[model samples]
Target: MKIVLIGGSTSSMTVAARLRRLHADWEIIVYQKESYVSFGACGLPYYLGKHFDDYQRMLVRSIEDFAKANIQIKPSTKVTKIDPNKKTIYFETSDGQQNTDTYDQLFIGVGAEPVMPKIPGIEAPNVFPFTRLEDAFGLKKLLPKVKKVSIIGSGFIGLETVEALGNLGYEISLIEAQPRLMARVFDQEMTELIDEELSLKNIRVFNNDSLVEIVTDDQGQAIKLKLASGQEVETDAVIMAIGIRPATHFLKNTDLEMINNGALVVDRRGSTNLKDIWSCGDCATSLNRVTGKNDYLALATVARKFAKVVANNMSGLKTQYAGQLQTAIIKVFDLECARTGLSEAEAKAYGYDFKSLIIKDKDRTDYVKHQKPLTLKVIMDKKSQTLIGAQIVGYNSAILRIDALIPLIWSRTKVDNELEQLDLPYAPPFSRPVDIINIALSKLAASLEEG
Candidate 1:
């Protein structure tokens, strides 16, 4: 058996490694468009701050290592087209050379691309979106001598970059078009915590400000920003952490049936609507198990999960994937923010009346000397009393606890069933008698009795 994987990021590398282990005789050829493979794109911010100076440390494995495992690795090579009907793909080598390859099984993990907003002077030099390792290297070379910086977007990457660079003593201002930073994930109260934290970090944040124009300096490097709010900010460098879309435009003219945002439509098992084609990672549509809808939730966990699903069915095994729960956690200073499932607003948008409870509790005993922790809210369906969503903003809070809640929501299990049995570990320095998750559920159980 021979397998051809078009992407070499987290999902494709994970699947290819396993398939090579399971069927050692199978010829597996992995094509990675970038020079690096299996590196943490999430660490781009830290890399910019010079936290890890060695660029070679970012890579997990080299092409020779994969060759040792009997897997053909093609780096700096792009898969130009996928013709499922013909069982072949048109590819482009890094140096502008063209080639074609045939495959028995194909997997695509092409991931997403950072959105470069259509604004005047956006094409100006030094205006950048640091999405890949190469982009990180390009941006890192400029940060050392920079004085002031303007950042667009206040999402995870935006805030993280703000803190990382700000800590390195750069005057930074972060701008977001929404009324609150990370508006899509957290509630109003949760956002307040982020605002306070960012303020303390000396990173100026501007909400409700949309980019109107990118101004350049005499040397043509981007230096000023004009916002929709009639505000002008001057800076030496402008970094765009705005939104992103799937990176499947290479298959644009092909027979792939994609959504409006260019995401290849895939089922829970990562199999596309097109025959003999499977896609995972940030490039494809991920099924929301709770909402029963096809939405794009580009998180690393789902990417690996979907890759396994494709690897399983291709190897002639009976397997099924339970779909995705968009769980995410972000760290800003000492504060931790995590969320999963659907929020209170999301449930109402689905036309379901839900109840949400806001809890303010100590992470540990008042005399225990453990720092204060706050769990913002727990949103649940009133009819079924199930855990629909939760947002936690706490100091030293357990981000993994929110991760544990994802499976509960995905299984459609009731909230009361998991109460008092979270089985979280107990260490005085970390947590108190009952974990915060259990405490919240216990509160919910008491509320049930009160009604």
Candidate 2:
């Protein structure tokens, strides 16, 4: 058997690794647009922060490593087109050359591209988008001369980049078109906490301020960012981190069902509408178990899980993607934030009769030194008392706890049942009189009774 995986991402590498393990005799080939494979793209920010050196360290597997497994790694090769009927792909190699390769089965994991707006002076040298190793290199080359860096979005990439560069003596200004920072995934109360943390780091943030245009200054080098609020500021450079759309342009000619931002539509087994061709990861559609609707959740954690399902099904094994809880976590300075399942706005939009409670609890008992306040909230259906979503923002709460709530939302666990049966460790140093999460949720359950 011969398998070809296109556009190397974490998911693609995972599928390749698993396939090689299961069928060692089979021919496995991976085509990547860049020399890097299995790159932890999320680490790009930290790389710039001087937290680590050595670009090769960012790669999970080298070309030599894959070769040892008999998986042919073709670096700097771009798959331009896919012919599902013919089971062939037209590709371009490093020398600007084109070739054709046939495969018995194919998997596409092209990942995504940073969203860029149609603004003037975008082609200028100073403006960039942080989505690849190339962006990291660009930022490094420009870092020494960076006295001030203006970021255009306040989302994950933007915030990470801001904090990464701020420590390097660069005057950072983060501008957000939304009224609140990280407002899309975070609530206003949580956003305020993030804003306060950023302030402590001496990073300036502008909210509800839209970038109108980018124009070159009189010197013809630096770009001036103009805002819709009739404001303008000169910036040494700009990194656009507004959002990302799936990098599925190559599959446009294919008859695949794509609706949510052109993410490839696939059923439980990762098989697309077309036969024999499969897709997963950031490039494919992600189903939200709570919404019962398809969405695009571009995260490394989900991609890894999806890859396993695709690998098994490709080998004639039955598997399913029960969908995701959209769990996410972020760090800004010393603060940690996490969320699982849906948000209040999402529940209301889904037409669920829901009620939510936001509560504050001490991280530890009064006698505990360095006790800090933590916020926890959960949204649930009033009638069923089922947990639909949960969020937490605090110090040392171990944001991984958010995953513990995923089953509650995905399985529609009753709030009372989970509260009583959930196995939880009791420790004074780690938590208050009652676990912070439990204390807040228990109060939420009580609120339902009064109504």
| Model 2 per-residue lDDT tens digits across residues 311-371 | 9988888999889888888888788898988888788778889878887777777887888
lDDT of 2: 0.84
List ranges where model 1 is wrong by over 4 Å. Answer: 398-400, 417-428, 433-435, 449-451
Q: lDDT values of the candidates? A: 0.82, 0.84
Task: For model 1, name the residue pairs that clash.
Answer: none
lDDT of 1 by residue, 1-451 (tens): 7799987887888788878878989999988898767776788888887788887777777777888999898889998887888889888997899999999888888888899988887887677887888778778878776889889998888888888888889999899999999988788888899999989888888899999998887777787899998999998888899888898998998778799999988887778877777887888888887778888878888887877877887787756667766778888877889888887777778877677888776676666775686765887776787778877878765555676677668777776645647787777776677777787777776676676
Clashing pairs in 2: none
- Please tell me which predicted candidate would have the highest lDDT against the true structure: 2
